[model samples]
Target: MAEVSNKQVIFKDYISGFPTDADMYITTSTISLKVPEGSKAVLVKNLYLSCDPYMRPRMTYTTDSYVDSFKPGSVIEGYGVAKVLDSGHPNFSKGDLVWGFTSWEEYSLITSTEMLIKIPTTDVPLSYYTGILGMPGLTAYAGFYEICTPKKGEYVYVSAASGAVGQLVGQFAKLLGCYVVGSAGSKEKVDLLKNKFGFDEAFNYKEETDLVACLKRYFPEGIDIYFDNVGGKMLDAVLLNMRVHGRIAACGMISQYNLDKLEGVCNLINIIIKQVRMQGFVITSYYHLYPKYLEMVLPHIKEGKIVYVEDTVEGLESAPQALIGLFSGRNVGKQVVVVARE
Candidate 1:
């Protein structure tokens, strides 16, 4: 087989603060389409790439973190949807559609088939795998239903509620007959939380100088469940506003990811005062429940009971900017990059 040009997004170095488009560079390299003889690797044509906040932590130089840091001068890796062109694995074959951890490139030779999931249904858009039916979906499902243990008529609050996981968490709360409110960074997202995602109340956090007072106004009875995405001050405020026996599912701390010095939450004593339970989770811990998750969420998606919003950029060249846009709140929904069609 002839060598084909592969366009890739390469990590420049370990970042100290907020990442920029300059932190990653696009370069072209040649690769043979065929897998090596006797290898259990699969060659994939990447379709869509997901830009997630979790990827930010991996950019830093760290050996103690749960996930491995991205190597400098190497192709950046993230979750993506792809089509199998050739496979040496028994579980996958040519023309198979899958979603998994793939490099930010047009094509990739994926050796870690364990991480790859075969796409069973094609009725929905393939890009949905990068957001709704993918990691974000499972994260929201496990974090809310499993961790929060939601009940009907509970008062629920979700931070970063217009983003991928948060949006779903709000909707799920509503589905369970809970009174749900959400917080976002902008007016447009605030509107989305109320009008589109079906939150009972929504607020723009940037507009509120006093977060504690803001939470008081929204949840006068105090929050029974808090789906924490943006931690720090928001968390501190929620700690004060939480009802006795409240549950907090710590999904992501987006507010602290880019900070040079991580902010401390002083109101942690409130957890003990109220006898509240606060738990942090990693999505990979619940991968065994993916089948059950799909069984529940997929039907809701097909029946129009749940909806997903995505902010998509076209081509491999747009990958870096799309990723950097996450920290700045430039994208209103799930950030995705379309690498190829088919």
Candidate 2:
């Protein structure tokens, strides 16, 4: 078989503070399209790549982290959807669509199929696997239902509400009959939260002079469940406004991820005062519930009861800019890099 040119986005070095497009560079390398015999690996043609905030942590070199940091001068890896070109694995075959951890390249040879999930429904856009039907969707489902344990009619708040994970959380809250509010960085995102995602209320945090006062205005009755996405001042404010026995699902701390010095929250007293249950979670821990999540969400999607938005940029060349844009809140919804049509 003839070798194919593989274009990839490679991490240049360990990043500090916010990452720039310079932190990653695109390069081309040649690879054989076929998986070697007895390799037990699947070769896939990447279709869509997900730009997630969690990837920022992988850019930094850390001694203690749940996930390993990306190697310098290696392809940056993240969640993506692909079509199997060749496979030595029993579960995957040619033309099968799958989503999981894959490199930032036109093609990837995925050896570890343990986490890879074959796409069962192609009725929805295949790109949805990178967000709603994949990692972000699972994160929202596990964090909200398993951790938050929300009650109907309860007040819920989601930070970074227009983001991949936050948008889904707000929609799920609405579906569960909870009164939901979301906070985003810009007016456009705030508008999306209310008009598009069905949040009860949405606000631009950048416009608020005092976050504490802002939370009070939105939740006069106090927040019964808080899906904390952007930590820092927003978390401190939410602490002061949580109702008795409120639950907090600590998801991503996007605001603090790129900072050289992590921001500290001074509201532990509120946790004790309200007897709140606060928990931090990584989505991989809840993979066992993925089947249940699909069963519940797939129908809602097919019925038009749930909606998803995506910000797509064409080609692997746009991956760096798309990844960097997350820090500035440039994306309106889930940021996706379309690598190939098939």
Candidate 3:
């Protein structure tokens, strides 16, 4: 392996309110792109890093959360696709591409070989691993199939519909013969949902003043399943329009990410009245189903039954803005940062 100065993104401090790029700083250090001899670790050159909403929680050092925050002054870590430059592990050989948690840097030494899954199919773009074929994909799969459990011809609604995970959930529901409607922050995103994703209907939530009324207009029969990505008001609105025995899969809450205080959910009684089942799950908890998720989504992707959209920012230097863009709805699709080329 070659010696190089690794350029990496560092967490400066615990974040508050909406985070700015100033909170993160890029720094460099001298390093060799190889794992030391006799160590069962793999050193990799990172290709793409995924920018996700949950990562905001990780920016703040919180002990109450299921996942720990990124340590201040350390390299920030996230899901990324990388090419192993050198390996001392039996599971991975040199030059193999894999995806897992990795630092936002040019290269990384990964000891958790178990978390890194070798990319079996390279016919698709390698960056797909950052979103559609990685954590976000698994989140969509698990949230839709396992949590919502939709029946054919059921009415389905997804908030933040044009997002990486939300878009997939909408399409999956449509594939299951369900009537799907999605709400996006912008008209462009709403158009993408209807035209590109083949959703039954889509609306710009920003334009809708009465969310409950808007939902009722679209779902006259009531919603059978809700794929919730933006919680708070959206979740409150959906609760009023949910059908009896409906299911809610809480995938994320991008709307609540920047708030100084988490918003309170207003309608708990609706859950009991409608016998609604609302479950919150972390992708890590359902990792055992990843192979099953792969089996289901990979074919759809290969056959063009499913389509993926990504907003790629060139260079690791743009990583800070790309991640912060998620909360502002500035990103049109799955936000990813290109750290280095293969």
Candidate 4:
């Protein structure tokens, strides 16, 4: 190992409204990558980190959010899959592959060993842990199964359907015998959702003049479940077309992430009239159900029933652009960054 340390991405300051790549930047540091002797921490070489929409909230200094914001001047922390190179903790040994919250850098000294879960299977690509097999997958599973509670033959709609979580949610809905439709930002994403991810129907939201009318046309009987990814206008439109007793799983709101003033939905009364139940969630709260999710999803992946899409960036240097692309619908699939290799 080199005596000098490596470069890491740091938050420049507390952001307001929307976040841009300029809000964060990469910097060099000389702090030792390894944990000090006798310290109950493991030193890890980060391989891949996931870029998600939720990370946007963490960039702001907000105490009301589900999680605390990332401190300015410090390395931004997010979900990363890494390989342990050294450890003073008994639970982990050198060479162990794991995934958890790690600083966006080549190496990170992870103090919370409990948060890091051992990679039990190497049969699949290790990078899967940064996406399909990690937090995104779990979020899709929990949101669909636990929140949406779809029944056979029901109608399901997924917004931003070609994304990391949206793709999985669509496939999972199909497996449960539901009529699933999805909306994406472009023709390419629409085709991926329909032809690749096996969604029943998909359309480019950009091409559609009125979202509510689009939903009404596709879902003639109205949507039984709505897996919302892009909030604001899309969500407002969805509420107008939802069937009686419809369930909405509020997975993300990428559409409103960058706006200075949030959009207001004009159809708030629809929720009460239709008995629509909308709920927002954080995946970390459902970590206890991970094994259950894996048991259900792993078989589908192995049997080739489940399909995942990802747009990967090469190094930590490209992470800022990759993450910023989420708000603009620039990323075609799950955005991930390769930080290092074992």
Candidate 5:
């Protein structure tokens, strides 16, 4: 077996509040190209890495999250597109392309192969395996259809609308003939939501002082479906503007992830008064729906009925900053870091 240089992003330490590039460091190491004998590990050369909001919680010393925290002085693990180099696992082979839980490095020896899935085809951009064709795509599909239970001509509202899951949710609602509105952090993101994703309307959430009143203005008849990506005041505001028997899919709470103490929502009473349903879901629970989602989305993508946007940065060296940018809304769309061209 041959050994090769592997460049990696190391988590320097557990963090509190917002994460910066300083929280991680770049380093080089060596790894054998072959998987060890009698092990079920798969060795891969990483091609692309995903930057997602859920990763923020893993940076803390301890978190009440579905995933484990990133270890200090160790590699940051995430979903990535990779080519199999060697494998002791029967399911994978040399040269096979896959996407799943991989380290932020040029190469990885992954033992937890449960999340790993072979890339079905390369007809679409391989980078898409880190976004639209991967986790975020399934998240939007399951959250909207299964959780929200949307209907035609219903009023839909999405928060953090230009981010990975939100963008797809807005588009999915529109395709179902629902009247969709979304809220993003910047004017540029707002424009992309309305023009690129085909939402009926989009607004910049940062400019709104009274979020409750702002929601009322956009959704006069009240929102029937709410995709809550950013929690805190925005969720409280939306609760007050939800129609009777409304459904809310709480995919994430990006706004509270960085805070030491989370903000409170003062509208719990509204849930009872409006008779609404709100559910918080982890995408891992919905991975079983991938094949069905792919069949439904692929034709729409090929025909230009569905579109995806990526804000890409190059190289393993850029991974830290690219990930940190997701919290500050520094990225325009789905944030992807290109580790290697192949």
Candidate 6:
């Protein structure tokens, strides 16, 4: 087997507070093109790397969390779209396109095939696997439809509404005939929520002095469902404004990921008083529903019934900054790194 240079994003070390590009370094190492004999691993060429908020938590050293922390001096792991070049696994073969958990490298020997999904069709952009067709997509699908149990004409709110998961949740709410409102950090994102994603109303949370008053103004009748992504003060506010028996889908808390001391929800008592059903979910648990999700979302995508936006940068070298940008609200949409076009 011939060897090729593999460019990688290596995690430097566990750290406190916001992670910078310094946390990850780009390096090149040689790798063989074939999977070793008697090995059941799949050798893949990464096409697109997903920059997700959840990946932030994994950057720290923590056994307290269910997700394992990224090891120092190793290629950071993330969900990406890939092309199999060689395989010792029976389920996969050479030239098979896949999307799932993979390392932040140009080439990877994927030993675990349990989470990997063969890309069903190439008609959609392969990068969709990194966003709309991958983890974030499933997160939104499971969180909104399954967790929130939204009904027609319900009042819905989504924080970080222009983000990968949040954008989809708001649109899904609208599709169900719900009145959707979303909050974002910038006017550009807020405009995207209202004008692009079809949210009934959108606001820049940065401009709001009081999130509780903000939600109350958006939903005078009180929120029926809250798709919370940036939890912190926003979540506390939503807790206070939730209607009786309302549902809350706790997706990702980008606001709390970098903090040493996690923020507490002060209006938790309102959960009991209002009888709100607030549930946090992990997307891995809902992978079984993926086939059903694809069936529903694909048509909506093709028909333009549902739209997705992505902020893409070229090459593996750009990945670290792209991932770091999520916390600062620097990317306009789903941040993706293009490793290989094919």
Q: What is the TM-score of each predicted model, taking all chains together?
A: 0.99, 0.99, 0.98, 0.96, 0.99, 0.99
The reply for model 1, stretches above 4 Å from the true place, is: none
lDDT of 5 at 200: 98
lDDT per residue for candidate 1 within 149-208, as digits (tens), equals 999999999999999899999999999999999999999999999999999999999999
Question: What digit string (tens of lDDT, one per residue) describes model 2 on residues 5-32?
Answer: 9999999999899999899999999888
Clash tally for model 1? 0
Shift in Å, residue 308, candidate 2: 0.6
Q: Score residue 303 of candidate 2 by CA lDDT.
A: 95
Residue 185's lDDT in candidate 6: 92
lDDT of 6 by residue, 88-203 (tens): 99999999999999999989999989989999988888899999999999999999999999899999999999999999999999999999999999989988998999999999
Error of 4 at 174 (Å): 0.4
Per-residue lDDT over 1-342 for candidate 4, one digit per residue giving the tens place of the 0 to 100 score: 455577899888987776787899999886575679799999988899999888888887789988789899989888989998888999899999998888898888999777788888887778888878899999999999999989999999999899889999999999999999999989899999989999999999999889889999999999999999989999999999999999999989888876778899888799999999999988988999988888887788888999787898999999988888887889998988988756
TM-score, structure 4 vs. true: 0.96
lDDT of 4 at 101: 81
The clash count of every prediction, one per candidate, is 0, 0, 0, 0, 0, 0
State the lDDT of candidate 3 residue by residue for 191-276, as single tens digits.
99999999999999999999999999999999999999989999999999999999999888888888889998898789999999
Root-mean-square deviation of candidate 3: 1.1
Count of clashes in candidate 5: 0
Which pairs of residues collide in candidate 6? none
Any idea how many clashes model 2 has? 0
- Cα displacement (angstroms), candidate 1, residue 218, comes to 0.6
| Local distance difference test scores for all models | 0.94, 0.94, 0.92, 0.89, 0.94, 0.94
